[model samples]
Target: MNSIGRAPNDQTADGGLLGLSQRLPPSNAAAEQALLGALLANNKAYERVAEFLIPEHFIDPIHGRIFQAIVRRIEAGQLADAITLRGEFEHSGLLDEVGGTAYLAQLLTAMVGIINAGEYGRAIHDAWIRRQLIDVGETVVNNAFGRDPELDGTKQIEAAEETLFKLATEKGQDGGFVTFERALTDAISVAEKAFHRTGAVSGLTTGLRDLDKKTGGLHPSDLLILAGRPAMGKTALATKIAFGAARSLLVQGRETGTMPRGSVAFFSLEMSAEQLATRLLSEESRVSGERIRRGEIGQKEFDRFVQVSRELQALPLHIDDTPAISLSAMRTRCRRLARTKGLSLVVVDYLQLMRPAVGTKPDNRVLEISMITQGLKAIAKELDVPVLALSQLSRQVESREDKRPQLSDLRESGSIEQDADAVMFVYRDEYYLQQRMPKDTMFDSADKFHVAMEAWQHKMELAHNKAELLLEKQRHGPTGKIDLFFEGEFTRFADLDTVHGV
Candidate 1:
């Protein structure tokens, strides 16, 4: 049998591959041979390319088997020269299929130098990547030709995009260890930036002073879960963060007379883009969005709204109001945004409404939620930006006497709690206390009812215009409650005055 596999369409007078140009995929057989030869000559050469290249990257099947055998022997604390590899292959009944001892000797002739092993391995890996791309293209074409009847055209597009993204990110075997010295250098850089910053905020600031002091701003590659029950200002809080980041980016750009690298991406799965914008306008103009919609604003208020809208037109905040968007679609859009305009933060307003990747039908709701959280975390890491995902709390919080949300109150708590780097709950005691006011009909006497009502009014007064951000889980910092002032009319949150001790 031929050592090089015979090509069916390349039969000629000498049975060579002169006419096999149209039949072969992209491959570098010579480079594979050179890399394997170097490995056989000196096992130390493997360290140069071990982080990026593997045996499957080889073009020839025999070469891949030989590389695997050599790796196995070397990793087992044995010398892996030509003689030892040949013996091991012979014992495993693979020597003859790998062109026997003669082919092994010929590889030594193919050896160029041990120093070039990394280059050769890279060449082989590049060819492998090309081959994979070809395969992906072919699969896309075949699926488009009615191979999968279950997927419609839009879903097929999502599937194709998902497959391409997977190959783009997960194809190469890269990123090994880093030295402790390099890590210390990064830490020192963060410290230096914090020292120079006005408020010592090391990461992206949330624009709330107490929250910034407690959390030190939003760090890159962090998955921060902002969760709460209904009517607890979860959407309002997320919108606040997105607005703050965008405003900061714009202000920094203007002050430095340079382009800013920070921008905000808000994914509003529940609300329309217009509604989100209106909320921001109301917060800035101190006018009620409900009244604006009802045309109850006077001339002065309308002019203020117009002026605030004009000012906010320059903020680099992008909103996507797509309902129930899948994770892959979000990733694709984020990547596109990052490519065209820089991205610093991503906000997904309510994670429960998001679907997993297309064509992934999990067996249960828990697994589906797990996949979605993992995807969100992966997006955070891949883009090297903070992802603030809003989540819903279970109704069990309503039954609790304290009404302060705990970690267990998170809807689909398992994956969400596990995957999040930090978990925060928005709690308003005023909301719960408002429901506890006693009525005249329920009390035995007017005096008793008035006493209960007075007690309830005092409790509401204590909790009014206040909201608590309970940090139940933080991977890198302390966990406690940070008080914030909430305006019910504007649906806005601000740093509470610490001197008065709210």
Candidate 2:
């Protein structure tokens, strides 16, 4: 009888059960044994896979225990060999359970060579990944079979995605240290690109010249927060940046005579795709969105809008207007887009409207926001792309005398500020000024009302079509306010023409 108490004929040569669908969880007992043997033979071999391989990656329970003992001894700066491991196991009263000292001697004999330890470790890790995939598949099947009634179809999908993401993150061996010389070479390459590139921007351009100048453009693996009060053009600013990135990709593709290697993904949770498209049309065609919706445009304006839409159709931009999208689903979609179209940038309409991963239920809204922000930052780093997330400020900003937003005004400021590489506030003085227009009833005399009205009108003129982008926090650069031109009718944001005195 074999380990399962079945007839020897029921077992396959590779240790898998036969006549039971001929299937067994993926594993590599031989590889696990060889790796453990290599470590026991030469303690130095432990360093080869120390970064990624763990005891849990081994298939054989005894092999995993032996490997873990070796790891502990080696990490503690103590010599680890077959003799030392046997002593440790014996001391713990598990020597017989692990096949005794005879098994330790057998493992040492199994070692092919110390040089092959890394390969053996990788084989064991790969088998472990396959095993985890099987488990995930089983879970998904069980959930579908009504194992969890609370998980509807959509929730189940999200849960599956989250599980896969977690598995990939935990088991993937993509992170390691880079030599300083290599890092310096990359730095110089970036500098060279910036030196030759127009505007000397080293990263993806934000479409606004001043913003690009201040930030050197949006960088890869960066999480930038664009926050503002309601009607402060947060979405409009984020859309402008997305459009700019898409246009840059298109221009680069044209220069190379090939499709852009990557595209922009905009997740608009607050607005429908059509509404966002209309706003883009308004910005480019200089037609009011309200007028476009109401069919108030002339034939010429309609023709302009159609032409703009045709041009924009070729831009490498994708929009998903999934209302209140879960973070896991968003990550899954981004990964899919990256695989198919090559994702360069991700823009979320607003983080506050997003829900955390499907299965997680945070105790409070603050924790929920923290999870979302951290997840976004993780996505940016994992995908090596910039994530521009729009955010809403707390009402405290409105209650202040100076309505300009600050870092403290960020809703759930702690996590948002900590996770973000940059935090910017979109403040339109015109919007606030419009709300405080002088009223005749507030003044006692006509002259006083007229004087006040004149002053208010003057302030309005100064702030008309103007906006301020306050860079409250920047991890890599200076923090200051950037002036922008905001046309409410078109819902557009552009570089303020300070020299031209617009």
Candidate 3:
């Protein structure tokens, strides 16, 4: 250890850890081996492994927090300098020891570096597997999985797994993953994995057939943007997806295991959770969305509402309807929900509505939008879950000859386009129908004048319950369009093939 390092304990002679090993690096080769032995002998983080060592690790708890802060800043694409690290510790009230602020800077300057996620991923896997092999009483490469020669393949596979794990335990893994020469190799592997189950599938599968077919599912660590202008059904689509994912996860998550249902956290920057729930209820119960808003339900309708509400009740769907939520505040809430209720999916209703950090608002709208989108992306990766955010399209879409949205139609399109793993646009042509009459005897059957002339005026009819789901960009799969049935009264989006016209 260094002259400034904490003194080592005398327990090393009795097969116990010298506390210095956890915080201070040994001064020489002999001391390094002894420190490694101390960690290997007494550490409980690894079950069966003698020791786990990384080339870059925390010297102490203070250093660990500083490292974590740097990692977070790096992931967010912000520079993590000494000043930033000190400020973080000071804010958290974590840097009271090691002679206060000046020492904090010194420690950080000495002990901060980046950790490659993929590289560390391999190391973690190795440490875990080595522990498993030793504790499970399995000989490393010495025994077969079974006596039968047919089991030889299984044993070989296990050996391969163990070998990979061993590589991870080392400070470095020598390029363990496959890098394909052709782009089609990526496609082929995805196809293979999709058709043949990769152990178990994670995440909720939205009932949208084409969406599920193309994207497989809304994957973890993804930022999926659903963009459309007002009255273009952006919020409705977002709410629909959130409802489906949360319900599905609650229905089929880890069946016969500890976590049978993974609850969803819906961070609504616009509507209240109750409002969202009512929308879901109206959709599920076939009640008119307007009627639900008007509270015009009869006893029978109320009964049906009560019944369907019960069905949706146990499905672990949580909603936090905080208007104008800051990104960090949203993150804190989501993490809390994840800790307490096992959160699986997050939904931010309309990204444009979000506020930037307290003191760091940009001067221009484009810059502000960019900051919000990037923050959402970071939150998605950090939480290891899918973040579905609703956005607004630019006015140019309506002005163009083609009403369908292009990449440029995305409001603050660049950053939103870059950060998003998938960008879906919702469009309704009938909403902008150019005063053309239907082809029924060249006369409009329904009109304001016609309604006035009729003696009975209780006329209400649903038009085509359909909308097109245009996949503008899909990072992992094919980008195309799919149509879905939209019930105006019920506020439900269903498969277009099953649509019934009125």
Candidate 4:
């Protein structure tokens, strides 16, 4: 055994790890100086420097995780230990990837040693962590700006636009001077306006009348969370937006001029893409679609399915029916899509069903959710596209007479409300009232039964296909709601204004 590789002792030169301590960063002041330099020069390079500065101890990846996690936790005003970390990693499904528990202990030992070395140690840690976050934030901001660092804000947008306009309109003429700042602001504004136009359906729109008037579109890089209690039409309303956006190009003239760059990536942790497609098909076919779900469709129904399938095959929508996805995996996939296909929009059919990757147990459900939402915000920024994630309300919502969800109702964790750029909830008063009779009317007890019958016969005749999209939140715009037509047969949502709401 000693013949092949260097003996285990060969890897350690000066008496195992004890020989290596002197080489550790700042072993005193020197280590602090080196770390400060790394943090100042490159914010993201700390992880590398962390390993480089103390390879003897952080040689293992788990140790790095532990070291980073503990330092971050300490910074956040929390205590850390194997018990807490083990629970966190297990809950977050990260234990195996975390390697072993002892590594975390070693990592913490290193953090405490480094952090307590003096105020300088703490300062270095803070600078390093600041750099890490700024690195992350830069990635986020760049994504939000869509590959244009110059697109910093409205001012940058205007500046860039002016530059382009000058180049086009001025041609060879030296059109005075369009300051770089002014041109950059103009360009950014142009990029923003272009992004906004994608979400605006020219034909039939369902966003709140008031809100729509203010925002024009949901805006790109917006992490929109649509949450509600079970059966609250969360999916129904989101689908309305999806269908509305897609059809705007189909029935209307929006997508006619330019070839599509990327359509939509609708990630369904709960529903299958085929199932969503079937719903849409039924809505378009104007035939009872539930029969197909039950596999009781006769020849005529099968014919309708065929027609619907033919129509949907051409839409620029892609669906992934993956269950229990990791945030990192989603980011990788979305980034690839954006790079290759120019992804336009990302939709997650509900968030709670997703799971963190295995190997690391999260300390608490709240932290796990925080990580997920934060990851999603990153993805939204990176892809420079809107991320529409569906969510569920807590059981507390059911306890209240008003089942309509507020930010507090975001199930699993409040971190969702904090992380999302925009939060929306879908509610249907009519759906809620099916259990209670109208107070003004004389109808009693059997009112729901009668209403169900009427919905099936009378309304179903004209439009059993009706739904309401309650826009409960819009971070930068108005908060209200809207109504739409829900076609059960086609699983398609239409502007109720086309039939009734107007």
Cα displacement (angstroms), candidate 2, residue 340, comes to 1.2
TM-score of 2: 0.73
- Kindly indicate the candidate among 2 and 3 with the higher lDDT: 2
Best of the candidates, lDDT? 2
Q: Give a tens-digit lDDT track for model 1, residues 171-235.
A: 65455786788799999999998899989899998988888888889999999999998999999
Q: Stretches of candidate 2 above 4 Å error?
A: 1-172, 411-413
Tell me the deviation in Å of residue 209 in model 4. Answer: 7.7
> How far out, in Å, is residue 468 in model 3?
0.4
- Candidate 2 per-residue lDDT, tens place, 271-316, comes to 9999999999999999999999999999999999999999999999
What overall lDDT goes with each candidate model?
Answer: 0.87, 0.89, 0.64, 0.58
**Which segments of candidate 4 are over 4 A away from where they belong?**
1-214, 248-258, 295-301, 357-360, 437-467, 487-492, 498-502
For model 3, residues 1-502, the per-residue Cα lDDT tens digits are 4434545444455677554324433222222222322222222212222223332333344433544555566546565655565577678787674245676444433321222222332344444444444433344333464544443554455444444433433433333554554457865765576666432233356756656766787787899998886777777777788777876676565465455446777777788888888888988888876887788989899899999999887777888888998776676677667656776788888788898754476988899898889988887876678899898888877687768788888745548998899999887665554233334354456574454434222221222455788898988779988878777677678767744432
The model with the greater TM-score, 2 or 3, is 2
Report the C-alpha displacement of residue 376, candidate 1, in angstroms. Answer: 0.9
- Could you tell me which residue pairs clash in candidate 2? none
* lDDT assessment of candidate 1: 0.87
Candidates 1 and 3, the one with greater TM-score: 1
Ranking by TM-score: 2, 1, 3, 4
Per-model TM-score on C-alpha atoms? 0.73, 0.73, 0.60, 0.54
Model 3 weakest lDDT span, ten residues long: 41-50
lDDT of 2 at 455: 97
